[model samples]
Target: MKKSILVVEDQSSQRKIMVEALQKAGYVIFQAGDVQQAIDLINQQKPDVLVADMHLPNGDGGDVIREARQLPGAPVAVVAVSIDLAILNQNLTATYQADAYLSKPFHPRELLKIVEELVGVSH
Candidate 1:
């Protein structure tokens, strides 16, 4: 089966772009605009990977990571995104147990590359 990915980003346009890129790469994509939406989707079915943005509307990436880690399919490969906050760097990988991360204003290819690495997807 094709691997599934959950993209938890608050920005509408950004989410659409990432989702499109991932779909082209042949991944089943799911997305959420806020913390509640993310949590709801995550509980229903765990995605093979989670790409979460740090600064969200209701909550941050930390909440998403922490919640995902507790799910049955735990230790879900996470790629946390932030807006050039050095502190977010330490938080994503360390505190939240994310496998990878990205800074905002980055190329879509970069995020896709990290997702590929995390899920072992080959072009």
Candidate 2:
């Protein structure tokens, strides 16, 4: 089965673009526009990987990453996405345990590669 991924981004256009790219790359994709929506999705189905934007409505992407780390089973591989990479912080991965970070204006291909690196296609 194709690995699943949850992409939490607030901007509609950017979220749609990234979702489309990941879908074309053969991933099972889930999308959330806000922190609550992301949390709801996670509660329903835990994806193999999480791609989260740093800024979000209701809560920040860090909330999702932190929660993902605490969930049952193997932890989710998290990729932090933000317009200001500085806000993501090097300590985020050490603290929250994210797998990767992607700056905004990043190439769609790079996002795919990062996700693939975290959760291989075979996974």
Candidate 3:
């Protein structure tokens, strides 16, 4: 089966861009605009990968990441995205148990590459 991904971003434009790129790459994609929606989707979808923005509407992406980890069958990979370089520089993988981190304003190719690396997707 095709791998599935959950993208949790508060910005509609950013979220659309990610969803489109991932969809084009042939992965099933689910999206959420806030922590609540992200958690809901995480529970319902149980995606293979998670791409979340650090800052969200109701809460931070860390909350979503933690939720995913607690699921019975959590996502295989979790990537945290943020505009704040400080957050990216920190060891978030240790704190949140994320698989990777991406700074915002990055090219779609960068996002694709990271997801591919995490999920072992070719192309």
Candidate 4:
């Protein structure tokens, strides 16, 4: 089965762009604008991986990752993205646990690479 990915980003355009790129890369894509949406989809779908922005509308992406870790499945890998790397990176050690991190303004190629790595697939 094709791997699935959940994209948790508040911005409409960014979520669409990420979904398109991941779909093209052969992933089944799911989207969430905020924590609630993300948690709802996660509970139902249980994606293979998660790509989320550090800051979100209702809550931070870290909360979602923490919750997902408790679900049944192979541990879901996560790629946490952020525009302000310094602020996001600060307190990140104690705040969140993800497989990888991507600072924003990054090329789509960079994010895709992380996805490929997480899913153990060639890109």
Off by over 4 Å in 1: none
Task: Give all candidates' CA lDDT scores.
Answer: 0.85, 0.87, 0.90, 0.86
Ranking by lDDT: 3, 2, 4, 1
- Give the best candidate by TM-score: 3
Clashes of each: 0, 0, 0, 0
lDDT of 2 by residue, 49-72 (tens): 999998998889889888877779
Candidate 3 has a TM-score of 0.95
- Is 3 or 4 the stronger prediction by TM-score? 3
Any runs in candidate 4 off by more than 4 Å, and if so which?
A: 91-94
On lDDT, the stronger of 2 and 3 is 3
Worst 10 residues of 3 by lDDT: 68-77
| Count of backbone collisions in candidate 3 | 0
For lDDT, the strongest prediction is: 3
Cand. 3 Cα-lDDT: 0.90
Q: Note each model's CA RMSD in angstroms.
A: 1.6, 1.3, 1.3, 1.6
